[model samples]
Target: MDINYLLIHHDELLTYLREHDYAETYVNRYKTTIKQITDNASNHNWTTYEDVYQWYVDQSYSPTYLHEVRAIIGKLEQFHLHGNFPDNKKSYSSFWKIKSAYTKLSSEYKQLYEDFETQTCKGLKSSTVASYRTKISSFLYELQCKGATSLSDVTEKDVLTCFFADGVRKRSGSLCANIIRFFKILSESGNEEATRILAYIPNLRIARKNIDYLTDGEAAKIRQVLEDSNYSLSCKDRAVGRLLLHTGLRGIDIACMQLEFIDWNNDRIRIVQQKTSQPLEIPLLPVVGNAIYDYCINERPMSASPYLFLDSRAPHNNLTTDGIGYSVKKIMSAANIRQEKGRRKGTHIFRHHLAIKLLSNGVPQPVITRTMGHTAPESLSSYLHADMKHLRECALSVEDFPMAKEVFQSCLK
Candidate 1:
């Protein structure tokens, strides 16, 4: 029960004690405690009974005194009930969320990000870092969706939903494979509970699929419109789009970028990609560098922090993956691109386009894997590796035979 009820009850009980010849000093102590509780009770706040009782118990109240105090607290509870206060008014969800938010971050995320930056990214070639990044990012993206900024409340469902299957019925068996690796890392970092919950997750391996690449003309069309889009889009937004398209950098890598990391002198740039903790240095082409320079000089606001990207609003924190997607969609709509990939064209498709461009340019499979950060050198070979019109040409080859070849040569002519 609330403390105000107890305070009012104490007053009447004190008067009865005075009638029984109790000394003024004894009655005054109870009066002071009651007054303090009453002031705190105006907002219905109560120190938990266990906390209060533990303190009172240490003061060594005799058996009779304990019984009397219990009776008085009971009277207070009854008074609270009669006065219209109810116990279940607050939502536990909000309380738990607040508690989790205030809780400290786990050592695991810090270690993984650090390790990725120092060991994985630095020692590895430019491309292998990208694979490490994808593995980590897809996992973190799941955490962000669940509103789990802290480690304590993270459970198996949060892990599975974030890293598991893409919700298609066809790949039902492959959902649990990567989560095993992720949970092992967490458990090794001393999160036993997260580990325990993770054990029940199943084991399944799924084959990877090919990627669809956009043609140069098609890419140019999208680029022109993305720049001209009417969302009053910031130079930073357009630049981010261009960077993704040109370099195939992941969203989190972009998010964690800093000004000092740019190596303008040598035309190479370094990034400690957030997911893999790798320090990847890409040879920044003039186009990509100019786009980034424009954003840094013209768009980015001055701040105490060094993150290359910041929110447009005050108290700006880091932008989440969804925020990045929302911007991409806004620009894509203005570009008049179809809005059909799960209700949106993904920013990650830029990576696919990059892969295709490398293939079409006759860039080797190992080179694509290295530049894109694939652990398995052959991983990216499954990409369309050929443009759409070329694929059509190849498919019609068996059907139209000599005529199709002449048609293809005539087109090149």
Candidate 2:
């Protein structure tokens, strides 16, 4: 499509859309107006819906363009009155209206998101509140673009179709996930019917196995590689590898660790997990302790963030839980430890490795559950699979011959 469609003189287009008598109701047409304006430009050869969609995500566009976008929003207000706020209220389209419904989130929906913001991650830094709010705004704009004037007008399936099959806008699974969660929260919070409507969404990236950890041998190899190449691997990476393998803590738990939490005298680590809000006191295993000590002494950035992990790039910045996986990946690549193709070398692998190591060592299931800070024992399946290598190693470690011969020799003696 024509890239110029994105080059729409939003200022000129908005001045034109403002003239329509039904401008308030037509605020939904901003996307179209923007497209049409681009179409009318000099040497307008061609364009695709994708180009227009990309324009929405582009922040480099002038603020004047944003103001023009705001002017187009006026039509959605007008369109909503005619379509949704009627005397009868039965004309539901059931079409996929992401931006429209998200833009005007009901109090129930907002409350669910707010709960996620406050109860899930305090100070709003860790919460998805920022992205969710952005999603809401994007949803409204999308609804306006789609001419989605009423929530009742769209069906759940219609939303799915628009999200997946719509050639106009190619939404990633992550975006769809956010949209789905918004509706799910709305559904859970007294709008019981909203749940039914959202049931149709394929529920993107719902990690079936919550704790995916690495195998003991695999973890051991990673550690040795890091230790050998002391110059290439950071102290934090080495410590992370060791702790992840030994303690099986999640990235969130690791990021939350501080010097005060380490009770060297008692040899325990006290952490308040975000998911369960449960205070977990895990004993400091020797391997984990060694790694921590080495990292702290050799690599910890001298900064105010007190976080166990720090970004070397931004020496003063705290290590975000978001970057934990990437950090693991970088170190893994540096170590030339691609034991498997297309498989990510991530922090979670350590947690799974611990589970496998425990189960294979004849450690009790209850103990394993508690050791890894798992809320339920049932969460061990993914770890079970990921630990296949550990199991094989355990099987191979046993010397199983001549037991009967030894018993016979003892009897003869």
TM per model?
0.50, 0.53
Evaluated against the true structure, the overall lDDT of model 1 is 0.61
The residue ranges of model 1 lying beyond 4 angstroms of the native Cα positions read: 1-171, 178-218, 226-231, 340-343, 382-413
lDDT of 1 by residue, 1-413 (tens): 45545655565666655764556775675566566456655544346543444444667989887655544443334334453221211212211222221123345554554453564255665555554455555555456558765555667677566534576432233434444655566667777765785675656556554544455666776678655645567777777787788888887677767778788999987887664565577888887787788877887766676777776543344556666777677667766665566543767778778887777677877788767766676667567554554476666444545465678789897
Write down the lDDT of every candidate, Cα atoms only: 0.61, 0.60
Query: How well does candidate 1 match the true structure in TM-score terms?
Result: 0.50
Q: Could you report the Cα RMSD, in angstroms, for every candidate shown?
A: 18.2, 15.9
> Per-prediction count of colliding residue pairs?
11, 28
lDDT of 1 at 132: 49
**Runs with alpha carbons beyond 4 Å of true place in candidate 2:** 1-148, 155-157, 163-217, 226-234, 274-276, 298-305, 309-315, 321-335, 339-341, 387-413
